[model samples]
Target: MTDTDLEIFAVAPPGLEPALLPEFRALGYKDARYGAGGVTMMGGWADVWRLNLELRGATKVLARIGSFRAMSLAGLDHRADEFPWDETFYSGTTVRVEATCKRSKIYHAGAAIERVERALLKAGMKPSADGEVTLKVRIEQNIVTLSVDTSGESLHKRGHKEAVGKAPMRENLAALFLRQAGYDGAEPVLDPMCGSGTFVIEAAEIAEGLQAGRSRRFAFETLASFDAVDYKALRRAVSVVKGPARFFGSDRDAGTLKGAVANADRAGLSAICDFQCKPLSELKRPDGAAGLVIVNPPYGGRIGDKKQLYALYASLGTAMKTQFSGWRVAIVTSEPGLAQATGLPLSQGPAIPHGGMKVWLFQTPPLK
Candidate 1:
């Protein structure tokens, strides 16, 4: 926190580690590499802000403030008191303390939380049962580590898309899927069953080079190291330019299409995005270079029986093969049988966990 060399952790969606690694390195963190659940990099508070603001694939950012060794509750209280509170937390701020302990003398997390809370209260910080600022205390093998959750809400919220269709894909996951599908922001993107427009909107943002967290607020603003003037300067340097390539999204439900349009408008991408009520059976190739088409169609238990969904997938496959010559396709679904029913030459994609269901992106070479 006070130190400019604190470790910053960027949480990535499971199965996208390789995709996230190159992103952090290209963002100038040479030390950025894959960690257990995310990518670990060395940076200060400003870097945390930058990651929260700009990184599209990271679902959350955690800043490791400091650490110590405490074998007993007395020892923990003593060490927590000496932490430089003035450098990280504002005085009189309400905060919540959450602790986890394993294989340590201070094995009781509740007792550990009480000790930390008492220390923070002694340092003029108020304790709130539920607070925006969270103090994560971890004790393992006689070592204690403390960190802060910089992103207020999950980064996937992205402060856009108020209307979400049933089983809507998270924004960050959509971005990673786009990258894995080989989208470089230079080509058109379409989603035949675009429920609330997550893929298409994410594509438009990537094409326009817009920051993912541009319209969002963060919990880091409540911390002591936050510099309002510096943050404003950082935002001033962000340039947004709409690209010429248009993104298209269509759904059979007119109400669903309306929600997609509203979400696009909120993201400031309505100008280059086209939405209409169209079913997969009638999906036609747009007049342009055949680009990538990514879709997360409804899969099992929520929409229809396996037999019915097979027909939908078959219709999608037939449409792509018949009309979309030279177009690449990515179909995300939880049912393998449905994917196979498409009848297109599909390569097995990595299995990504989505909404508690394991989904894979079945990709095809350009339709011949």
Candidate 2:
């Protein structure tokens, strides 16, 4: 494909296409289309780096190198060998090949992988049995598409949060929820049930102007044509400004509170965040100021029984109405009925698909 004709893939939370589309457009990507797991746009590799660094809701960014119709194993081998594998794969680097085939003559994924590997070997590039550079091959309806994973280890693992509580929200989902709640780092943000403080940490990072990818290396860095100096220059150009991040996360579980603190410290955000071990009954608004309150309460399967979780939701709702007047509230839950238990007038925000769970983001207007 030409440099201007790149196929860019951005993985988003399920059902968040409407919310995330504007974000892609804001980044200058056009012709955006929704796919099964995320969205596809036509852009170059530079857009991939910008998405990974700037897009808060994206789970991963991939560049589609090429696609062709492959009717049989021989066709797959021919197509694989025809690509410039030498330009993509380094001689000493180990490459991991992952393939998925559906309703195609090349149904045997193992055979397809073998042929692809053989072709790579013929190109004088050795594939390590255990390596970081991953090549993802997807075959469906006699069509095969080859893509190189630009973001390794999923962008959600932002290199913080060494310890996570049960049923912790991924960083990408947390950022999406924050965006849905109208969090722009200018207002005070609180996570009352902040297990491992994912929301608060993301908020702090945004408020502080931190680059999400600064702490980690991306797979694109290993590409043959990738310019390390240019990447560093681009990274340096992304300015980070420290701001008053009125971000707070409180959990009754002391262990989770500790985890949040540790994560914030590692992320260089401890000074900007306030972590506490406090119950919902004692939860107070930050300095009695109107801000955003986002909570991911205990779902039935994870920490509490169904009956107890219902009570938790009920109490959470009561507290929000009684104590958090004029504060916008966003609650994330797998159970829609539990949101009803909150007893607050909530408008359904979005039903985001996450990790095989269909989750609803419920929002309530600021209590008068």
Q: What TM-score against the true fold does each predicted structure earn? A: 0.95, 0.93
Cα lDDT of candidate 2 equals: 0.81
lDDT of each model, Cα atoms only? 0.87, 0.81
For 148-170, candidate 1 gives per-residue lDDT tens digits of 98997889998877988887889
Residue 365 of candidate 2: its Cα lDDT?
83
Per-residue lDDT over 1-368 for candidate 2, one digit per residue giving the tens place of the 0 to 100 score: 45668888888877775666666776667678776778888776666777777777777888887789999988887887887887766776677888999998889888888988888788877765676677888999999888888888788888766989888899888887888888877888899989898999998887776777777788887777577765666573434335454889999999989999999888888777899999988987778468889998877756578777888899999989888889999999888889999999998876666657778899988887
| Cα lDDT, model 2, residue 113 | 85
- After the best TM-score superposition of candidate 2, give how far the Cα of residue 275 lies from its true spot, in angstroms: 1.1
Lowest summed lDDT across 10 adjacent residues in model 2 is found at: 236-245
Candidate 1 has an lDDT of: 0.87
List runs of model 1 lying over 4 Å from the truth. Answer: 1-4, 236-245
Candidate 2 clash pair list: none
Best by TM-score: 1
